[model samples]
Target: MSNDRVLNICFHGVGEPQRELEPGEDVYWVTADRFAAILDEVSTWPVPVRLSFDDGNASDVEIGLPALVERGLTAEFFLLAGRLDTPGSVDSAGVAKLRSAGMPIGSHGMAHRSWRGLSAAETTAEFDTARTVLAEAAGAPITTAACPLGRYDRRVLSALRDRGYTRIYTSDRRPARSGAWLQPRYSVRHHDTPASMRSGVLAPAPLPARARALAVGTVKRWR
Candidate 1:
């Protein structure tokens, strides 16, 4: 990694799911052992890495936080405002606990739905109201956001900017510019191991792959 670029590694649910998961969401869940192994591996990287946990799973506070704390690492947690206090989800106490532990809080929107082509009301709920609710939960202002379901387009990006978010995260699977307002992240999946993660993330993408990734991000921004 260069001084200008940093890899953003994001984790979803860790350990067993306490409640029902959204369709296809299970693929993102990694076992407790796997999570620990990957975290241990990533913490040793010579390059810069930014860690974040998305979706507000109860395991975030239960498994994610302790493991991170044990390693003396800190990460940002992006929570779903609508799911707060629900069974199997991170509750109010968990949010406060994470904050107390010195983890930054961000919003993953009100509901875990695609941020593309949303109705006006849906947009308000996801972008505007969600931040308000999540900020209240965090007991601090929420200025960063991640697009729900890794989906976003021109409208989505514009709305987020209009709302004055300082950092906007996306699952674009590419290393991000360190100071860019829009950050792309590589999401860890159930099948991802340290070796695979190293190849997929630390190793540079081929020319064609890099071009494709760039094109995809560009299209997403303008569409």
Candidate 2:
């Protein structure tokens, strides 16, 4: 990756266990701790981009936190207010620990629902409630949010900006450019292997054949 191609890496649903809700069905779950190990490796790249984990799951505190601590790295965790079981979710104490360790907790909206079909009042309520819950839990205001499922329209951005959210993120299958409340993010999948990760996140350079190889080698190490 060149100096300009540093990708902003973020993980979704870390350490948040998923159950099939029915027997004989497949299930998917990624633990925060296991994902943190991945972050540790990716974060060592020459250009350090922002690292973030989505959804306020118990595993975030259990598995993901320790890895960040070990690597001396900090991340922003987004919370879904209504879906969060207050006690099991990152509670006041858990947020305190994250803050003490230099991590910031953020909001992921209420109920992980899309704001595309909602009215203005409904949109405000969704943003406000999640911010309230996470703010109370973290003892600090949350000014950033990642749209659940990356679904949004003009109204969504307007509501967030009106509510004073300066940074808004989306998992909209594209690379992020510094923009006004419409930052794009690449969602790292559970099935991604080391080789796939390098190709997806690293950008190719415009150097000679040998120089390109060197750039890719150096960038791969960071991945």
Per lDDT, the best of the predicted structures is: 1
Candidate 1 residue runs with Cα over 4 Å from true position? 205-223
Candidate 2, residue 67: Cα displacement in angstroms equals 0.6
TM-score of 1: 0.90
Q: Candidate 1 local accuracy as lDDT?
A: 0.91
| Deviation (Å) of 108 in candidate 1 | 0.4
Model 2: lDDT equals 0.67
| Model 2 residue 101 distance off true place after TM-score fit, in angstroms | 1.3
Could you tally the backbone clashes for each prediction?
A: 0, 5
Q: Taking the tens digit of each residue's C-alpha lDDT, what string does model 2 give over 1-223?
A: 3334335567755544542222311122444444655675567545436677776666567767887787777778887787565544555666777877889878888866777888767676688877898788788888998887678888788878888998988876555554445677666676654455555664332234336558677635433
User: How close is every model to the real structure, measured as TM-score?
Assistant: 0.90, 0.79
**Candidate 1 residue pairs that clash:** none
Candidate 2: regions farther than 4 A off: 1-6, 15-28, 31-37, 86-88, 178-180, 204-223
Clashes of 2: 5
